[model samples]
Target: MVKEVNSQELSQILSNDKGRVVVDFYSTECPPCEALAPLLIELESLYSNDFSVYKINRQDNRELALELNVRSSPTLLFFDKSHEAGTRLSGTITVQQLIGAVVDAFQVEARTLIVPDAHENIWDVLILGAGPAGLAAAVYTARAGKKTLVLKGKAKSHLELAHLVENYPGLPPLSGKELLQNMETQAQGFGATIEMGDALDLTFGHDMKLVTTRTNVYKAKTIILAMGKGQHQQTIENEERLIGLGVSYCATCDGAFYRGKKVVVYGNDEEAMDDALMLKQLDCDVSFVSYCKSTQCSETLHESAKKKGIVYYPDARVTSLSGQATLESITIETEAGTKTLEAEAVFIIQSVPSKSLLRKTGINVESKDCIAIDKELRTNLPGIFAAGDITCGGLQVAVAVGEGVSSALSALKYLRQNS
Candidate 1:
């Protein structure tokens, strides 16, 4: 059994610890945390002498959560010799991943090594984003009998920020988060290994491409540059000053923290409507501010917002985002006059540009912002491919799905030809 510790006892325990320890900092309420708890207990029973597993309630220890800069719940911390030095797994993790982390953290041979197996150096496909497009690609690739790995970038997927997506086919008016959950589960169900991390840098050579994240480096024979645009930063006073304070891009990830609070969605695009609806679900007084001339939100989204009494401020440009230490309010420039709206959080949606990883790697982008590609979806770089918003197609879920399927087939053909 893993010993549960609180902040009051953490200092004392760390002071007396002799060997390796794994601190599972988790909240009882989170589903992913709950999913991991039993596995962790089993690991504790399996490695009693080599390591000790301890649980810390994040809610109980505000001081500890702050000290460790705990961003999300159910985070796992591995302390080799002392609690002061450690590595952490935030959000969700798998048994295999956790085992690998333990092996690396404790410098012990993984239990799996007991069985000798042939090392097959084959990663049939490597998709670099987890948005709808990337997820779609993984599903198709894995279904095609290829070993696939998906490296999820930040934004998780721009599709995820959307709150209500009535336009996505088959799924009847689902929240963006729920829709993304289905996509993720589908990809996972098809034997596609989804790794939660970012591909910080990408490089292509004659034979293979290398993607380096902060945690690890992955090599692939063929690469899909599905990493869509990193959100454009809102250049407002104190906006940069108060990033984690209240300003957030991910509603599902952070909406619960600001329950019943006032939040503003900045943008006139479909994603803005989606985010506004998510905030509304948290019982927050939601408002949508659009700088765009016309709001492109669907009828379902507009009706939903209207029924919820969420306000819409069109032709409004946020001149400044201000707060003392956290977000306080946003100043908007309108045709009438400059006005201020008090808000605890601001969701900047217009920053969703298309060029990202492909740009950095020198893949040709056209004037219309589509990645220059043939019908095959292969970029100028021979082994590098692109799909979804990264291409010149309109940013819609249906288009992304079709592009993803096309890209996967094209990549498979490329791999087979070279192999």
Candidate 2:
């Protein structure tokens, strides 16, 4: 069990001059911190003797948090013999990442606590998204008695954000939230499980498809792509070439790799702001490049960032990325003039098309980055279907629902024949 410690107790523990220590500075009402709690509990259960684990409420212990430079919730600090050890991990972290941090901090090997094989939970139909297309597909598949599962990403669906949805059939005009709630209710009533998490990676076998998230893995006999459009893809030079080399879309997944390095984040959403704060906690030279107007960001975030002394570039856009083999600098177009900023890494967070997931499965996508699907909503790969905005179908809710039903029928047929 992880013990809750105040600043005084924490300072005393850190200065004990014995035993490896792991301190977690967390906050209430923080989703990422909530998600990290279970993993931390499991870690303590597995390595109680190797290290001592403690938790501190950042909100209650403001002075200690400031002194320790814990600017983000769920900031983890490792210590060895009264000295800091290893790099701190902030934001959402996977089990593998946690283990790696422990090894780096204490030189202790993980004997147990292995991640269960993703292939363990093999559903008849595994939907890659939980948008209109995915939820619609689940309604059909679950009614047909096929084990259906939908992986809902952290990013809210475009439809969910819409203020009103007027044209969905068999329903009166209602708010987007209401329409989605009805769909979710219908899907769940039919015995479908809608799990919330992002699909971090996907792999295909001859008969099975494997999907990985930060905390869990899933398997499906048939897969459906209803992930909607990609809105994050910016048309910057050398962006594609530097994907793993430097350019990243997820700060939580890649921020640790650039500890104490120069990094630039381009976006105006909550996720982008959170990423910027996380990088700052890791001692990275962080800069915020907001494409939105100055008033767009929340006052809390804007003020907190300013207080942290993070550089801000409002109303700016990245025009190009320059590097030989890896990213070296980024050129931004601001109101003042075009300027190049020296950056070791660039993180662009936005919504774009879901083309990369399609490409990974060897599925063909059109020139406009839309997945190609037949009238039946089936892709080139057997037992795999595409629907919703991802297929370049009309962006209307009614159209996505129709395509979702069609794809579900096609998937049902494929499953019956294979069985």
The TM-scores, one per candidate, come to 0.47, 0.63
Please list all clashing residue pairs in model 1, or write none if there are none: 163-274, 370-392
Worst 10 residues of 1 by lDDT: 112-121
lDDT of 2: 0.79
Q: Which ranges of candidate 1 are over 4 A from the true structure? A: 1-20, 24-50, 54-83, 86-223, 227-245, 259-262, 267-287, 291-312, 319-329, 340-344, 349-419
Error of 2 at 418 (Å): 4.8
Candidate 1 vs. truth: CA RMSD? 11.5
lDDT of 1 at 2: 74
Error (Å) of candidate 2 at residue 93 is 21
| Count of backbone collisions in candidate 1 | 2
Model 1 lDDT per residue over 198-302, tens place: 554454543555565534556577887676654454466666566557765445445555667898887666656877887787789988877767445444456
Model 2, 81-104: lDDT tens per residue? 989999898655546567878999
Tell me how far the alpha carbon of residue 31 in candidate 2 is from the true structure, in angstroms, after superposition: 19
